[model samples]
Target: MGKEKTKIRLRGHHLFCSNVMDVDGDPIYSARFCANFRKYQQMMADPSQAIEVVCTCGDTCRYCPSWNEQDGKCRLYDYPPNANRIDLEMLEALSLSVGDEITSGELKQRIKGRFGTTLPAMCSWACGFESVLHCSQGQRKL
Candidate 1:
C-alpha cells in the first residue's frame, strides 16, 4: 500500500476559497502563492486526507505575497484585520472552528449544502482579499 498523507492544514476561510476559486495561473497571486495552491489541490487528491482548520496563517498563507508574519494575517486590511474577521465568519457558516479536523469531501459537501446557490455571506463583504476572488461566483479573476 502507498504511504498515507498527513492532514492538509489551512486557514478557516481558505477552506471556502479552495472550494470556490481556482487560481492556477493567475498573475494576481505571486508565484509562490500559486505554487502552494497547487500543492494544496494535490493534497486533496486523497479524499480521506484531513483538512485542519486554523485561525493563524496556515499553509496557504505562508506562501502568499501579502502574508504578514507579525500579525499572522493578510497585510490587506491590516488596520481592521478583516482577514481574521472574514475567517471567523466562514467558520460560522460552515459550523467549524479553529483546530477542527474534517475531511475535504465533508467540507465540500457542507459548502455546497450551505451556499451552493447563493454567495457566501462572508464573501459578500469586500475586504480586499488579494488572492481569492471576493465576488463573481468564485471564478478565477484572470
Candidate 2:
C-alpha cells in the first residue's frame, strides 16, 4: 500500500472496539475505529498526543445474534475481553524502545486492506443510520 497522509490533531488517539458488528462477524462501521486509527497515526507523526488504551471488555467475546440459541453469549463473544483495545497499548508499548515515529505507511502495511474499510451489510445499515443520526437536527455531538 502507498503512503497515505493523515491529520495531525487526531494522531495517537485510540478507541476501543465495542460490540458493534454484524451476523457475519465483520466490523459494522469503521468510523470510530478508523477515526482512532487516524488519530494514532497522527500522534505518531507529532508525538505530542500520545494516548493510553483501556480494555473494557474482559476476554473471550464475540457478537453472535444466534448466540442464545447456540448456547453461546454472542454479544460477549463478538467483543473479546482484551482484544479490542490493544491499539493504544501497542503504541505506548512500542514507544519505549522505538525512536522513530510510526507513520501511516507502517500502519497500512500492518492492516493492509483491512484498514479504511467497513463491512458491507453493517456499513449500509448501522453506519448509515449513525451517519443520518449524527447529521440530523436536535442531536448533539457526543
Candidate 3:
C-alpha cells in the first residue's frame, strides 16, 4: 500500500493572510474557515500547485448573512461580479499558483502593495471586524 497524499484546499482569502500563531507558537485561525489553507501554508513554500478553491469571502464569512451553511459556500460569490477577477489579479500579482510555495513576508508585502494596506486591515475589512487594527492605530490608511 502507498501513503495517500493529502489534498489541500484553499479559499480565496488565504492568499491575503497567513495563519496567526498563538502564545505557544501554534498557528490558529480566528474562525473555522481555513483548515486546509492553514495547513497548506504551513506545508508548501511555493503556492503554484493546483488547489481546490471555494470562495474569496475569507474568515469574515462566519458572520455574513449571505453565507450558505447548507452548501458551505458563499451566496455572494458573484455579488461583486469582479470577485473572481480580484482573486485572480491578486494571485497574478503575487506570482502564486494554487500550490506554489512562497514566504510569508513575500506574500504579505505583495498583498500590502496590491491593496495599499496591511494584511490585518485587509482581513478586518474582508471579515467585517468592528475594530480595524491598522486603521484604528492610523498606521496605514486603507
Q: Which ten residues in a row have the lowest lDDT in candidate 3?
A: 20-29
Mark the 10 consecutive residues where model 1 has the least summed lDDT: 133-142
TM-score for all models, in order of appearance: 0.78, 0.22, 0.41
lDDT of each: 0.72, 0.30, 0.46
What's the candidate order when arranged by decreasing lDDT? 1, 3, 2
State the lDDT of candidate 1 residue by residue for 3-63, as single tens digits. 8777888887788777656666654468777777768877775677799998777777766
For each candidate, C-alpha RMSD in Å? 3.9, 14.1, 7.1
lDDT of 3 at 114: 68
Q: Provide the lDDT at 89 for model 2.
A: 44
Q: Report lDDT (Cα) of residue 83, candidate 3.
A: 54
Residue-by-residue lDDT tens digits, candidate 2, 1-142 = 9665443221111221221212122233345433543334334434333322223221112222323434332332225563323333433533411223433334333322332233223234323444433222211210
Which stretches in model 2 have alpha-carbon errors above 4 Å? 1-32, 57-142
RMSD of 3: 7.1
Best by TM-score: 1
| Top-lDDT candidate index | 1
